[model samples]
Target chain A: MSDNLPASLPGQSDRVVQVDKLSKKYGDNVAVNDISFNLTKGEVFAFLGPNGAGKTTTVEILECLRNPTGGRARVLGYDVSKRSDQAQIRKRIGVLPQDFNAIDRLTVRENINYFGAMFKHQLDADKLIELVDLKDKRDEQFKKLSGGLKQRVGLAVSLVNDPDVVFLDEPTTGLDPRARRDVWGVIERLKSQGKTVFLTTHYMDEAEYLADIVSIIDHGQIIASGTPDQLIDTHGGKKTLIIRDAGEEGLKQLPQGLPKAELRNAGDIAIPLHNGELTNILMSLAQTPLHDKEIEVRRPTLDDVFLNLTGRRVSEEGN
Target chain B: MRSRIYTIISGHFKSWYRSKSSIFWTIAFPLLLIVLFGAIFGSGSTKFDLYLQNQDLSANTPTYFSQGYITVLNNTGAFNLHVVPAEQPDPLTYVKNDAQLHNRGQRLLVIPLGFNATVMSGKNATIQLYMDQSDQASASLAGIVHSVTVSYAAAIAKAPNHLILQQVGIVTKNIRYIDFFIPGVIGMTLLTTGVFGAVNTNGSYRELKIIKKLATTPLSKIEWILGMVGYQMILATISLVVILFFGYAIFGVTATIDIYTVGLVVAASLLFPGIGMVLANFVKEAESADAAANAITFPMMFLGGTFWPRETLPDIMKIIANFMPLTYVNDGLRYALIYAEPAQALTNTLIALGLASFFIVLGSVLMNWKEE
Candidate 1:
């Protein structure tokens, strides 16, 4: 309900889920190759990666859906490899797979209630329906819902047990902008409730807005891991000042006080800066080439951080 | 984990039940087929229409024999008999009319002039029997009736004066239409329940990626299999009750050993659906599963003696039926129905059960929870 979360509580555990050297191979192609990470309690951890980068494999293993070929994982301090401990771990975790499918024939309420019955500590049926904002369509068939509603229902299903950790693999994929924002609202609520949310996404803005700690995985290995701000401050690139002017002559004849910039277009120049001197740059641009023109100053984002670390833009690297 | 298994199973069952179209297609359609087939084929049905042209019906005619010969020939039991007196005089014209009726599949018996004189003279008299051979059963029945007539004529010739002939032998087997039909219905019921029920459901779930979600859950392969088997067992039980009642009400197919017969049918029903699971697992997709199931079921429905006697089929087809599992189920159901001998049915049933278990195990092996 609140935008700002409370301070970290005292006497909380550092790790809620731990994976050590997990690897899974399908004949020739390796899905997860000797990768490991730990998720602390009440943290919104983002698994940032391009498609086929083993983010899903790691999430699946942590959810106990997959048995790792060569590593160990524990959830809520229970060994996933042990049969007796798997049920205990699964009881504490919830998984929202990439496809986000429910039985097409059942009504929405039945779908939620069915999964709710899986765990001992499940949410009330009405409460879960309200949580997902699907109460209005509770009696509708599962297949009749739109994609966004289906995604919301999936999140509701994940929360059915009031789980310690919720695993969402590309939760906002295939959704329109509005639907993505709606899902973002749901995730924010989950974080406020102090539920650990482990999710994977290619959307830089999504990770920037929701993740407390972002881990960028590539080829089954975590290439970068830190808080979003820390990663941008350290490995990420400089903030940029984009200026659109009347002509190239005015841009090239910029004053000496302005910083060095890249020519983005004939009438536009982008100035990169490590320090926050956007006001000074704007003041200088007012008197010179960018006078009576459009100018924008922005901070470094997850895309910039990825570009700095990988030497290619996130979108370009995805392909 | 136990709770999760229960939840998943109940979830699947509830979801399937909620789909009205699927329930109709899966459960109701077969019942409709039983009613249709039973109604059309159940009663003591007649297969042909017969016509008789008697030129010498009057006892005063020289050809007329004792009154007993006329009594037997004039009797029409299971045929539609139309008698036209021969007073029109042109018997050849009468033969033409008779032939027309015969061409339309009517059994026509033409008693020519001097037919009674020949019989009274102790000579072998011939009553020309004509029928359309296009209808095979009617043609066969005509042959049998003709032979019976000739035997009657011979008996009359042997004791012309003592016209009341005795020393007759009649043998009848007391088997009803239900006796033949109930077993076939059971076989068809099991075939549909096994093939369409399991295969179509399995394939569609795979296509929808529903299985992938379940795989991610803490549910084990065995648990999933048990859940499915449990769902089908419930469906099959309901179907058995409705079908058995239908059999008795419409065809008088009494489940005489109502309890043991039920127990056997239920066991067989459960056993057969295992084959469906096997097909579902092996085929991998809905279209392929449907195709494979039809390929197996349609032939067996016809060739395995579910509808007709396997003996009527070519020897090669009968040999083919030997390999089919439904053949055993059908025969075993019949044996159980008539004699209430569960033990007599056991040997065939064990074979079916063994095959069902094989399919179940094979289905499990083929079902990869984590498919690409």
Candidate 2:
């Protein structure tokens, strides 16, 4: 949102990050198995996985902060394995790691300014502070800041180079609800500026909201990858129909093509929508339900999609 | 390249200077020791007790030779004579009793029999001096007495007399404790600011994930480390000048301020930042890094030549002191400051340069920006 982040140069490459069959292992333990992904310009790709699921390892490889054990990864069209290319990639890419921090002894402005000096070309530090909504805190020492403010500084530091691709690993893990929303706002702004954002988070709702493309990993392998609606449509459970206070005659009047109806504990007869029959069954229910009865149709959510894909809640799988 | 390094150097400097604790540790701490010790011992004449026994059987009353020698001794500003009554113990017995009690600074002077007659007759006279050998306090006092006696005898005889002592001195001036102490202070300040600053700050940056973040930048670890060393040297150079100036201002202590002394300190400073980086590789957390650094530095502080010369140490400790790096730092600065011989400090400077190279390379090996 700041002019300091020069308009994404018109000649920038389309694929900001690309990975194919990347893997990482710590001695006998395989941290990341072969995985492949790619990012086009101005897209927010959310990489979600359980703990030890290799999401971080994948991101770290793309950020050039780790050496992949097998296969190849490139950032800004440069092969990450080449030492010469690493410098060039680092110059063009920004990374905000899990538990990232700015120098606590330095003020916010100084922290950003120091990081800005690390690159050949940099955004204006004062403008970055203002962009991150830290104008009043520009001169305040980082140690005295709250967690949310510190993360804001980390965000500003990540943007110092006006990077082509930004890696935000678990950017909002420990934030409160309000701070989480504030950071989400910043990510939204980054996307608006045509910056390719590679994000890894456990918050399915976050992935659902901010991600244009989503990839789910488990046990060092990607279990599913697609747009949020596509993943939900593919891996999600059947839609549920709940009809309350329906008389026996109304139940008898229901469409026969619907799957066997069962009475739920909440005094509602719940019916599952069989494949390709949700629309017809819902229409039949609309015709049968009395005026006083309550009726509801619940579609599958991202959390359900994650559970259906991984067989465990995202929070439970990660922890 | 210069811009990247300057960024890191300026960033480090701003962080270090703004902290009150760092300013105290780097500048105030050393200056306090130098000024306090210099004031305490730099501006005074040493005082020792002397008891005189008259055994001049050849003289009837107080003779000129005996009275004149006593007056000379008193005027030398070195002796505080104890007025004893006639019933007091003999000078030797009094000195022995003082020694047995472990008291310090008591000495005895005995004027020989026929003292005035023998001296007036132009014949050599021998005066006996007694002191506590184990106490280590009588060396200066005994020197003063012997010189006064021999000179007075020469005046009476109209010729010089033969007298021998371990050290040759005219006793016109006493060397101040500060003059002997300023070099040690400089050595210590450089050691602390260099080693502790490097170890603690680098280790803390690692612990806090600052280093990991910096790794994402285009700057390499070598550049990062060199930048830190450059910054510390600037701080150390400024501190060296200011502390030496305060030494001269607060007390009349003078140190040789030549290019060689500056080189010794600068070369010495370049070694520790690398050492700190090496130390950080082994220390995991900020708090533990401080403990580990103190564990290494505290013993070196007392055992190295900073507090006392290595020659005074026991044979085994001397061998250990030779291995401790700060000993060379102390010795190098001591040579430059006192003897004005940078050539003599050559061996130490080379070793410091070697260590600077070794640890910096080793630090780069241990510091992997990619490793979690």
Candidate 3:
């Protein structure tokens, strides 16, 4: 894999982050196993996992917030485990924590300007605020803003240094749909500007849309890592039968010995379609009650790949 | 790094000053307390007024017990004696009339006709006293009269060669309570700003992940501490001025607001944040930090001679008072202001500075941002 990676890439080939057999343990509890991966320069790498799947622990280890129990991890060519390299590493990378907030009394502009002062090189604060679409709210105190606006301010502060690499941990968690889209726009701009982004998310659609590479981690291990299309092609089947708004009684009207599908919530059944049986299944279900409802045949998504690899189910919430 | 420190200090000040409620709490609250306590306790001198009626003057013996008691009470300058007139008759009428005219601690002392005869013969003698039980000042007047009579009786019972205990007035300064209380109120205000303000700032930042954001930057822990303590010092200085100005203007406090008093405030500003940080190190959340600050400061507010004097505390509490940093703050400021004792002020300053250094070092060592 390493030989192919080096040869297939044209001229630019450099690893921005390298982790070799890294592990972190709290007494007897191992939060991160001996997992290893490398992030190339100028790539958006997504670490996908459930609540305690060691995604944040690994990010903290790379951000130099925690110490590793064994093996090595480096950021921007400096060892993260060494205390001497911290000042250097911090100057080059920006981190947005899970519970991040600013001084509630300061104006939004003031908060961004305050963070800019902590670095040797910084972006123009007004321009940065405008980039996050907060120019009109620059004068308002942080506490006066809504939760969504506060997240936008948090993102602006994270980019205050114009860092080479930015770490966003669950950046869009607990946000409304519109605010989530706002953050996704900001993330896209960060990548298009050639900044390497390391992100972790519980939303499978987020990583599927924004990530160049995705790793599915579960119980302190990475079970799969690839492009979204590649992973879906490998682990997920070709097509799925999506049935919506059909009642339980309606679903029971289908003929026996027909191509069956997995039952989803609210009278919906989505399953991998069997090969060469789609015509036969439709003919058998023509007289059934399910034919009156909405149905679709589509390709497998990264969500299906994720469910297949980690055994974490997709509920009605749609990830 | 210097820019970062300046940014933090200025930002802290901006946040604190923008809110009208903060100004009222940090500046106005202490001023209110100083005016209330200093005005109530400050104006009057500690002198009790006594109207003495000598019924035994005509039946007096070789050793006049009334004369001896009167001599002791007047010699210490602790009592103002007004002889009850013969034409006026009742001592109680004289005292009641005096109380109606002046709301002072006025008392009536009547000597029985055979009082001196019984005392010379070594028999028990009774003296009558008229007091105003409703008045706070009159509550202590009876105790003073009793103590003085006990001393006079001891002098008469023992021989001429026996123990002759004399009360001397060495303090000489007719210092009112406002003069004594102004410095203590200033000390209290400093403690409030330095400990509670700084500790809450540290704890909330840690709780909100603001510290984590800074920790990820190039900001070191030392820079963070210095920026916070420096801001607190500024706040303490501002509080000192408000309390003292009201003390002098309204309550007639006489302490010269000089450089040494300012130095005491500055030292406190530098000192108490370390104490606050030490307490903050033991807690993980902001609410617990507030409770911890209260746990440390509420006892100190009473025992450090803030509203009450240290001399008034019990023996055990007085011993505990000696160990608090605010005690030294109160001591140094009092000595500088009320007693005009430079040597004592210097001694207190040294102890406070030494303790401040210890707490700052211990707190810095224990300020761990990483959670398990």
Candidate 4:
């Protein structure tokens, strides 16, 4: 496993996290298998996968909360598997575990300071609270905050130590859409401050929106790794043209020479668009009865990229 | 490390005071129990109740000397004397049942059958008194009986030494039920707060992923456990002071805060929470761990002599109480605070400290500081 190490060791380079063929097992079951990735400084690296796709196991190993069965993982230049190195790693890294809740009776500021005190040095709690835009709820107990505000407090706590790198495991997993957006705003702010963030999420849009580099993992292995646009362009099948509210009648009324169209779930007619064919397709549709129907071109997303590669779509709940 | 542990302790202390349920359990409920138990058993008639079973008979009539002895005891007016039939074979059992029924002290005074003959012939006669050693009224009652027996012997036989009064099972200490109960209450408060506090913090914090988050920080597991134990010590001290003060204010119960008392408090602070951490590790879920904690603490409270003396328990329960950690704590508290027996208190304190070490070490070993 040491042979797989890169020429430049951590701290010698800008690599904040380096995993060399990391594997974690539980007796007979393998949770994370021989997966490798690297996170550089000031980059938001997203490990995207479904619910049981070993995301948490991998993140915990990097956080020094778990040991790898076979291989090596280092965080902030310290080996996670070594006891001496784990202490160093723990001192430098910040972590927000999946479904983490702060001390219930503590106010938002108190909770932040409570966790902050675990470090030798901590960023100001008031500054963190302001960064998360939770100034009004600073004095409120954690249990009294809304889910969005509670998550904001969690973000503040994770940043309390002014860590070299932050690990956030499914930070917005169970929040409403608006809450998810609010959390995204906090992550954007973190990015603007040039802090390296290692995020694990099942939400493809979350990765597409926030990550500079995305690794899509499945069944304990990484299927693809690149920027969202690169993965989408390489694996995303085809962009389509959709006629809004146009029923099967729109498909039936299509011009004879046009590509075959199918009716979708919302009674819209969809026709695949190939490169350099958009102008010609529009000219063909201009003379048809369906030409008057509301029509627009749709681009492929990370969802399409995942579906095209895996032959299955991850549900909204990451099933 | 010191600052981290201090922060954890401060955080927990703040949470404890902020929650109404926590305040109610840690402070209000124990005080309430003390008030209720004190009110029920702390006050009563000032007169001692003594049961007399005169077996000395001549043709089923009381002999002259025995009748004279009974009259002398009555004239003292220190006892509300009740009569047991001379024909009763087992007077102790009868007194036990009768005394319990009437809410009186289970003490009996027996006169021998040959009292009249022995006294008239100028030979020695014996009067036997049976009483529980721990009874608060035993010393005074035995003293009265002794004085009456001496004067009666001098009046009837002209020899004060001719008649003997044998006091059985006597320990001369004027201790009331409240005094005994106050120490037990302190022990009880230490128990519930330590156990429930540890269980809820460890179990529910794991569920909330707070432990997981803390594991990623610079804090070590030892620091966290030390913080918890430190918090428990503060809480234990609070309970001791508040309950002792309340007991003094309400029932005039005075207690000495000796080194042994401090040792027992420290031991209990580690011991109960150690048991609780062990429970939480096994039970896993917060609610189930709570139920498990109840299963442990409720039986220990009742069988550990919290509300009554182990001597009053059935033989089997007394034997069981010997193995309970709280029994030693309660016993030690009573010795140091009320009884002032240094030797016994030291023995119990050592035993409690030993158990505390074993459980706390075992609990620390079993706790999952990191995800496995």
User: Highest lDDT among the candidates is held by which one?
Assistant: 4
Ranking, lDDT, top scorer first: 4, 3, 2, 1
- The DockQ of predicted model 2 stands at 0.54
Could you say which candidate leads in TM-score? Answer: 4
What is the iRMS for every candidate structure? 2.8, 1.4, 1.2, 0.5
Total residue pair clashes for candidate 2: 1
For every model shown, the clashing-pair count is 2, 1, 1, 0
Candidate 4 off by > 4 Å: A1-3, A247-263, A283-289, B51-124, B130-171
lDDT of 1 by residue, A1-319 (tens): 1111222222244577777777888888888877677778899999998888888888877776677888777777776777787777766788888876777878888888776765567788889888778879999988999999999988888888888889998999888899999999999989988989998998888999999988888777777888899988888677787777545676576777677776754666778865667777777777774577777776888888877777766563344
Which CAPRI tier for candidate 2?
medium
lDDT of 4 by residue, B132-164 (tens): 878977788888899999998888878899999
Full candidate order by DockQ, most accurate first = 4, 3, 2, 1
Clashes of 4: 0
Off by over 4 Å in 3: A1-13, A314-319, B42-171, B257-259
lDDT (CA) per prediction: 0.70, 0.74, 0.77, 0.89
Candidate achieving higher TM-score, 1 or 4: 4
Among residues 3 or more apart in sequence or in different chains, the pairs in candidate 1 whose N, CA or C atoms overlap within 3 Å are B63-B116, B63-B117
Of the two candidates 1 and 2, the one with more favorable DockQ, higher being better, is: 2
Q: Lowest summed lDDT over 10 consecutive residues: which window, candidate 2 chain B?
A: B164-173
| Candidate 2 lDDT over residue span B199-243, tens digit each | 877777776678878888888887887788788788878877887
Best DockQ among the predictions, by candidate number: 4
Q: How well is candidate 3 docked (DockQ)?
A: 0.71
Error of 4 at A249 (Å): 5.1
